[model samples]
Target: LIAYGWHTMVTGQNVVLYSRLHLVCSRPRVLRGILWMIIANWFISNVPTTVFVFGASSANPGPFNRPYYVWERLQLCLYFVQELIISGLYVYEVTGMLKPDFHATPPPQKERRGSVLSALGTGKRWKSRKVLRHLIYVNIFIVILDISLLIMEFIGYYEVQVLYKAFVYSTKLKLEFRILNQLTDIATSRMRSS
Candidate 1:
């Protein structure tokens, strides 16, 4: 995961530099560096998290088992890493707002002349925009999914310790949340238009 992140960083630099040089490069290298670092951190942090997810799903062990111990530890480590990365990303974003560009320049004109939403249809920014949007949506779903799993874990720890049952329940919650969130977007659009 770290290797993949490093590779993405190397490639993303040239890609981002080419498309957004006019905007991002105008800032000091330090600011730009911090921005990229935050993203790289997020990518690296996901590695162990993914492993823990797969391990927990397959082994279906309670929190007390030797096998479950390793996965739980990995999950905790990944959570802490993600928290740190999120904090750093927040700081980087806020500090970037303090830079001279923040005062001198107006916010990048939003895509009002056209429509950023059009990216969905044209397949140009779809790779960048739509994919990213759905990724965010899925990540939100994952967090909710994790919360439900944690609750079930506690229940299992106290009561029956039925790992398979909790797994099924958590999986169902994840699917339901995903569907509801998609519906939420549609509902919001309708409400705003009305």
Candidate 2:
């Protein structure tokens, strides 16, 4: 039950990250590649982690202890890198959308004239850009949370690390809905209006 729960939470969090890429990114190839990496990382990290964690806790733990210790460290390292890659991609895409020349298509005729008239005033693009910048901040906050988990993991408190992960993942999902969803809606509307 423990191993299964751990696998679900860890893998599920990555899937959520993967699913949100469409909000800021338009490239299907990049999205597909990332999905593959997440799946591969799951198999590469989870199986041994489950086996070792279980074996290390068994009645005959002497042999399993050495391999489990080494493998768990490797597994955590893999997870951290996989997470950083996904978050880093999210940051990159959001930042790209922040650029002035990001959109390939020009705005409609009316919008272009209104944009010229309201040169001094902020517009939807500006608002979305602001939201996107704050989105980066949220990602940084999440990275900090992950760092705290690493600290706990290194401190060798397995129980506390597990509990803390649930808190961190829940917080991330809530932040995503509150902020990322706003940006997604903005992007979607712009695409349709264009």
Top of the candidates by lDDT:
2
Instruction: Provide the lowest-lDDT 10-residue window in model 1.
Output: 16-25
Q: lDDT (CA) for every model shown?
A: 0.42, 0.76
What RMSD does model 2 have? 4.1
* Candidate 1 residue-wise lDDT, 1-194, digit = tens: 43344234333432332222222234566546645754664555445445544555566645435545454444434443443343344334323522332234322447534665443223322232343355345445555554554565555452332443345334534543453354345435435745
Clashes of each: 0, 0
**Model 1 misplaced regions, further than 4 Å:** 1-122, 157-194
**Candidate 2 backbone clash number:** 0
Compute each candidate's TM-score over C-alphas.
0.28, 0.81
> How high is the lDDT of residue 175 in model 2?
80
RMSD of each: 13.4, 4.1
